[model samples]
Target: MPDGVASVTLEYPKKISRGRYFKPAVFPSAFIKTVQVHDNVLSVAIPRGAPDAFPHRMVWRDAAGAVVHAFTDPAF
Candidate 1:
């Protein structure tokens, strides 16, 4: 679990066992129903396989779906 959001850290097999990060991402919100993995990021989806809406910003949500404060997207 992340400091405040509902996140899971997965360990991959290193070098050939590592991962690359993709930004411009989204997750399930009040308007969305599902969270899915797409490419290297999380994609927010609607119920029953409907089209997805673009989210301007997103961070990890707590187990209760409350947004996390510490997991803000780095302003790099």
Candidate 2:
């Protein structure tokens, strides 16, 4: 999260197959839901059906809808 971040988006990972030769790819999990920022602390609920093995992403955005900061849990 950043100083000007107005909202935080919780992205649940969804696995996608690439091919038999290459590993799978993970993409497009932004804006699935948003959480409120209170006193610079954000608390969001993970969906019941969200994948437990993959790490989720948090995308912080400003009021102008520009991404201010983004990070993924487990760093992978």
Candidate 3:
């Protein structure tokens, strides 16, 4: 990872049962300067000189603000 660049990979279920669908994950706007999604890969860029913590937990939420997915780096 380079300075000002943060990335995370998201994995979705391959099989969806009836009436099940995928919802987009929402990231914190204040911490991220830009976002790019390619397949299951999600990349977020933090502004240069931004005061933030590394090895942070990334949270994904549903429309009701409930946690749908949450993860932190395993190697961290």
Candidate 4:
């Protein structure tokens, strides 16, 4: 976390299984504000620093700690 950082909200699709449940993705920092699930969409809120030219990578994992999704934001 850094000074002048702003809070960000991200949304993702919630995966459902017959005999298993998907938990909210775990973030590396404790500054995460809230995690909400509604209408099959998962919303995550956290603090983010100012944007730069370099791409920012976001990684998501399942309950087993296995990476299930990854994305790079060029604008953030």
Candidate 5:
């Protein structure tokens, strides 16, 4: 993020169904801090002890709070 703003959302398994056993659970959402750099890779910093997140797109808005860019890859 150019303006130093970023976020992340994670979703865990709701339940597991195998054979004759089922475990139900819900995982809370986690947010990551946006690391900004004038030049370099743009990545979000996840909280400590966090697992890899699921595939998702990032929605970027301008300082005026208007949608500027949205994509899965910054190179886009």
Candidate 6:
């Protein structure tokens, strides 16, 4: 988060498949705070068998109310 953003939403993969392709799914608004009130850890369960399975996306707004997004990496 930029500026003074305190919380953000996390979108993860969801298991929903058809014949040969899985339907697109987005688990919205998994709240994550930048400034930890009690603990400084965030955890989320990733769904199996999606195109962007491991690289989950997080969304939030900056102080100017501009949307900001980030991708999670396993290497990090």
- Which candidate achieves the best lDDT against the true structure? 2
lDDT of 5 by residue, 1-76 (tens): 4653333222223221222464433335534344333342455544333423432345555444455565563211
Estimate, for each residue in 8-67, the C-alpha lDDT of model 3 and write its tens digit.
Answer: 433322222223364433333434222333444555544323323342456554434455
User: How does candidate 4 score on lDDT?
Assistant: 0.36
In the order shown, the candidates' Cα RMSDs to the true structure are: 13.2, 5.7, 16.5, 17.3, 7.7, 7.8
Using Cα atoms with residue i matched to residue i, what is each candidate's TM-score against the true structure?
A: 0.25, 0.54, 0.32, 0.30, 0.34, 0.32
Question: lDDT values of the candidates?
Answer: 0.34, 0.65, 0.39, 0.36, 0.40, 0.44
lDDT of predicted model 1: 0.34
**Residue 63, candidate 2: C-alpha displacement in angstroms:** 1.6
* Residue range 1-76, candidate 2, lDDT tens digits: 5577788887765654446786866554523678767667876665443444233677888878888888887634
The runs of at least 3 residues in candidate 4 whose Cα sits more than 4 Å from the true structure, single-residue gaps closed, are 1-39, 46-55
- Pairs that clash in candidate 3: none
Span of ten consecutive residues with least summed lDDT in model 1: 9-18
lDDT of 6 by residue, 1-76 (tens): 2444534555443332233564545444333333211232445554444444444456554545555555664332
Output the better candidate (4/5) by TM-score. Answer: 5
- Please give the range of 10 consecutive residues that has the lowest summed lDDT in model 5: 8-17
The TM-score, computed over Cα atoms with residue i paired to residue i, of candidate 2 is: 0.54
Candidate 4 least-lDDT 10 residues: 11-20
List candidate 1 stretches off by more than 4 Å: 1-4, 7-55, 70-76
Give candidate 2 regions above 4 Å deviation: 15-31, 49-55, 73-76
Comparing 2 and 5 on lDDT, the stronger one: 2
lDDT of 3 at 54: 42
Q: Model 4 — TM-score against the truth?
A: 0.30
Question: 1-76, model 4: which lDDT tens digit per residue?
Answer: 2222132233322221223364433335433222322433455433433221122454544444455555655432
